[model samples]
Target: MSKDYYKVLGVEKTATADEIKRAFLKLAHQYHPDKNGGKDDKFKEINEAYQVLGNAEKRKQFDQFGANFNGAGGFGGGQGYGGFGGFQNGGMNINMDDLGDLGEMFGGLGDIFGFGSARGGQGRRREPQRGSDIEAAMTIDFLEAVFGAEKEVTLKKKITCAHCGGTGAEPGAKIEECPTCKGHGRVRRVQQTILGSIQTEASCPSCGGEGKIASKKCSECNGAGTAYDTAKFKVRIPAGVDDGGRIRIPGYGEAGDRGAGVGDLYLNIRVRPSDKFARDEYDILTKKEISFTQAALGDKIEIETVHGKVELKIPEGTQSGTVFKLKNKGVPHTSGRNIGDHLIEVVVKTPKNLNKRQKESLKELGI
Candidate 1:
């Protein structure tokens, strides 16, 4: 039976040339043998269909003869349309136009497949690269972490060149196209594959992807597009941030090469412990000692909190390990929206070594 190229490429007979090309490209990307879940037979079948339908004259002849037409036009003298027996006898003929598109298709996927260089180990392009990220350790007092503070940090790293504005060109230098790639930023090479002779493209190794070079190098950065210097910036620490917390400062990291973006700076915060208070989440816990007289008679006493010293009422007959809450006396929220409470634990101190006269007076009152 004659093959239907239109059904093979999944396009209508009235489909335009661009539509047919798009369908072929899409299917080829899906069934490329190198990709996962791709079948070799399916890939060859799609390519064979495109070989006929992709050509105008062949498509017209196919439309006239219909799917059952196996005569002898494009399929090599009565070999029939459905017979791929030509595979054993070298039937992998690809069009030059499709070859260029295929090269472009593979060229854009260099990063994905890590296709560094071409055949014979050709050098790869110097692609634009980002700067390295920075991490710094910071130690702050407990109060500072609770209330937040701004601190200055100093770092020594590469910074953007002040001269020539990171273009790597001197005050008066001529910028010219890359000699290697001829300003195309990419170079094409032909290779023989299982699919037969094919052309593929890669980034220009000499000039990178910019395809441009400077005649004179910058004096300040020496053509590196960046310089080394000490930089200092203030970092804002938010409130209620616990120990082992992390703060991110964006774009403050090392500068990228060839005028790319900068990286980030991460601050690892370590909060010092307080002597008088302990913390649980956002709440502050403190222990206070009260005399037995004060606990029995119900007296007001000063208690220490993260916020400040506050008055706490000791209720009558209060026992040891009794807890009291002071609202809004703990840590403040990072957003300043709300505050936590301060938990106060009371410890009663019993009077000891009473006088004998005082003991006898208590016995007489009981008699």
Candidate 2:
């Protein structure tokens, strides 16, 4: 038996168009494959129900036929009703002329059918599809991260083909109806279940469910509609971007197929190990070594900061483990208004070797 479209979308048969759409959107967001742990089947079900109920003509037909009409050909041999179009024993066929007008229709249908479709007309079919957000890891020098820097990275990804303009067909070639789908682009298969026969619809494999075939394939893309390309992108690392911090670069990811809008890129930054410095959110920490004599007598020492080297004065009788703060020398705030500070930790070093004259002088002074 055919599933009840109203029940699938959790709406009444007399529900308004807006109501149907709201229910579908709610369910679709919940069951989306990316977020829903591989629940593609649920997503497909929700999309299919919406396709039938969302349209006035299709809903009328479904309400009247209750899966009995099966459109023009019946279960396995007729054209689908109300724009359902292609259904054949072997496969479905699609007409290229119909492709331009079916974007909204097919997009909604794809939601039901577990696929996605592009929008627009031939030669101008691209839409402003939201770019997919991307995530990547980057490592920078600790000092560079504190001060901020621009980095160039190479990424390999699938991009729309320039040769055929992402149509997968040669320029000036004609499109023909698919013999398999007979211009419907779909097929029905009946299975014997415990409750008797159950019919299911699937995309036509021969024409890849577009229901049309190209007479000549594009040479550059090999009829795949997309090609692999290497891209170089410039990413900006902010001063305060620490380990595990994320940076968003708008529209710098894989291009959508067939002139669809580009996706965004995200960078997950990881600071490289530093030999001389460590970092907190916006503060830099470094250990400074001082001789025991210098610690007792006090001295001027040069310390490295994210900006440059600065002189730090140690007070007389300073302790071995004293810390000094250098103002406005650490990472810049993301707000771009102020900078952080640098912390210097003092460590007194004892002499490892002593000369005979040094030893004799020390004995004369002490003993």
| Every model's TM-score | 0.65, 0.52
RMSD of each: 7.6, 10.7
Model 2 off-target regions past 4 Å? Answer: 1-136, 167-169, 172-217, 222-224, 350-367
Winning candidate number (TM-score): 1
Residue-by-residue lDDT tens digits, candidate 2, 1-367:
4678788899988899878877876676667666636377777667667656777877887889885644322333243452433211222222322322342443442333222322222342232244455677888877667778899988877677888877778888789997766878765555442212335555554565677878887888766567788878687887677888888887787665544567788888888878877887888898989997899889999998878899999988888789999999888987789888999999999766899998888779782
**Stretch of 10 with least lDDT, candidate 1:** 111-120
lDDT of each: 0.74, 0.68
Residue pairs of candidate 1 with colliding backbone atoms: none
Q: What is the per-residue lDDT of model 1 for residues 7-121, given as tens digits with 9 covering 90 to 100?
A: 8789998999888977877777777778788778887777777666766866776788796655233467464453332433333333433444554765543322224445225
- Quantify how close model 2 is to the true structure by its C-alpha RMSD in Å: 10.7
The positional error of residue 24 in candidate 1, measured at the CA in angstroms, is 14
For candidate 2, report its TM-score. 0.52
